[model samples]
Target: MRAVIQRVSHASVTVDNEITGSIGAGLVVLIGIHEDDDEEDAAYIVGKTTNLRIFSDDDGKFDLSALDTSAELLVISQFTLYGDTRRGRRPSFSHAMPPEPASDLFNRTLRLFEQTGLKVQTGRFQTHMEVSIHNDGPVTILIDSADRHRTRRG
Candidate 1:
C-alpha cells in the first residue's frame, strides 16, 4: 500500500452531489493498493498517518502530529497512484489490485484508523467522485507501508 498525504486547511469529497467525507485542518490522504498489499500494509498506514508530525507546533516547526494536534483525516482511494506510463502515452493500472481486494482493504483501513481512536473520514470507493483541496503549507508526504516507520532524521 502507498499513500500521498497532503496537509490541508480543508478538504472534501462529493459523490453524486452528496458529500461523503470532509475535514478541516488535517491531512488529505490519497491511497493506493497494489496487488501484493495485505492487511499489514493497511495496519501500517493507519499508524503512520495518525502519528505523522506534519502539523505545526507552537513555535511553528514541523513538530506536532495529527494525534497531538487532534486533526481529522480525509482518505480517498486512488488506484491511479499505481498507474504505469513507462511503456506508452497511456497509463496502465496493471500494478494496482483488483477492485474487490482494493475496496476490501480500503474499508478495512478506515476501520483500523477508527479503532485507533482517530476521527477518520473517507471518499466513496469505486464511485464517480469529485474532491476539493485547500492545501496548507503545501506540505505533502508520500508513505510506503514498508518504510512507514522511518524517521525524517534517519
Candidate 2:
C-alpha cells in the first residue's frame, strides 16, 4: 500500500457531475494498493496517516498531527500511483492490485479511518472522478507500507 498525503485547506471529489465527497482543513490522501498488499499494509497506512505531524503549530513548526487537530480526511483510490514507466512512454500498471481486492482494501481502510472519530470523506471507488484540492503549505508526503516494513525489520 502507498499513500500520497497532501495537506489541504479543502478538497473535493466529483464523479459524473456529482460531488462524491468533500472536506475542509485536512489532508487529501491518494491511496494505491500493490498486488501483494494486505490488511497489515492498510493498517500501517491508517496509523501513519493519522499520526503524521505535517500540520504546523504556534511557532509555525510542523508539530501537529491530524489527530491533535481533529482534521478531516479526503481519501481517494489512486491505482495510478503504482504506474511503472521505466520501459517506455506508456506506463504499466502491472504492480497495481486488481480491482476487486483493491476495492476491498480501500473500503476496509476507510472504515478504519472513520473509526478514528474524525470527519472522513472518500472518492467513489472504481469511477472516473475529478479531484480538487487547495493545498495548504503545499505540503505533500508519500508513504509506502512495504518500505516501512523493510525499515522496521532492519
Candidate 3:
C-alpha cells in the first residue's frame, strides 16, 4: 500500500458531475494498492496517515497531527500511483493490484481511518473523478509500506 497525504484546507471529489465526497480543513489521501499488498500494508498506511505530524502548531512548527487537530479526511483510490514509468514512454500498471482485491483492501483501510474517530469521506472507486484540492502549506508526504523497514541515510 502507498499513500500520498496532503494537508488541505478543503478538498472534494466529483464523479459524473456529482460530488461524491468532500471535506474541510483536513487531509486529502490518494491511496494505491500493490499486487502483493495485504492487511499489514493497510494498517501501516492508516497509522502513518493519521498520526503524521505534518500540520503546524500554535507556534508555527510542524507538530500537530490529523488526530490532534481533529482533521477530516478525503480518501481517493488512485491506481496510477503504482505506475512504473522507468521502462519506456508509457507507464506500466503491472504492479497495481486488481480492482476486486484492491477495493476490498481499500474499504478495510477506510474502516481503520474511521476507527480513529475522524470524519472520513471517499471518492467513488473505479470511477472517473475530478478532485479539487486546496493544499494547506502545500504540505504533502509520500508513504510506502514497502519502505517501512528500510534505514534512511543520515
Candidate 4:
C-alpha cells in the first residue's frame, strides 16, 4: 500500500457531477494498493496516518498529530500511483494490484480508519473522480508500506 497525504484546509471528491465525499481542515489521502498488500499493511498505514504529527502547535511548531487535533480524512483510491514509464512512452501499471484485489484492500483500509474512531470520508471506488483541494502549507507527503522513507515532518 502507498499513499500521498496532503494536509488540506478543505478537500472534496466529485463523481458524475455529484459530490461523493468532502472534508474540512483535514488530510486528503490518495491511496494505492499493490498485489502483496494485506491486513498488516492496512493496519500499519492506519496507525501512521492518524498519528503523524503534521499540524501546528500553540507556538506554531509542527507538533500535533491528526488524532490529537481531531482532523478529518478524505480518502480517494488512485491506482495511478503505480504508473511506471521508465521503459515506454505509455506508463505501465504492472506494479499496481488488479482492481478486484486492490479495491478490496482499499475498502478494508478505509474501514480500519473508521474503526480507529477518526471520521473518514471516501470517494466512489472505480469511478471517474474530480478532486478539489486547498492544500494547507502545501504540505504533502508520500507514504509507502515498503518504503521506510517518510516525507515532510509527519
Tens-digit lDDT string for candidate 2 (10-63) = 999999999999999999999999999988999999999999999999999999
Q: RMSD in angstroms, candidate 3? A: 0.7
List model 1 lDDT by residue over 10-111, tens digit each: 999999999999998888989999999999999888788888889888888898888898888898999999999999899999989999989998999888
TM-score of 3: 0.98
State every prediction's TM-score relative to the real structure: 0.93, 0.96, 0.98, 0.93
The deviation in Å at residue 92 for candidate 4 is 0.5
For model 3, the superposed segments whose C-alpha errors exceed 4 Å read none
Off by over 4 Å in 2: 152-154
lDDT (C-alpha, whole model) for all candidates: 0.89, 0.95, 0.95, 0.89
Native-to-model Cα distance after best TM-score fit, residue 73 in candidate 3, in Å: 0.3
lDDT of 3 by residue, 1-154 (tens): 8999999999999999999999999999999999999999999999999999998899999999999999999999999999999998999999999999999999999999999999999999899999999999899999999998899988
Question: What C-alpha lDDT, on a 0 to 100 scale, does residue 2 get in candidate 1?
Answer: 90
RMSD per model, one decimal: 2.3, 1.7, 0.7, 3.0
Give the 10-residue window scoring lowest on summed lDDT in candidate 2.
145-154
State which candidate has the highest TM-score.
3
**lDDT (Cα) of model 2:** 0.95
Give one digit per residue, the lDDT tens place, for model 4 in 1-154.
8889999999999999999899999999899887788888888888889889999999989899889999999999999998888996998989989989888889999999998777899999888899999999988988888864456565
**Could you arrange the candidates by TM-score from highest to lowest?**
3, 2, 4, 1
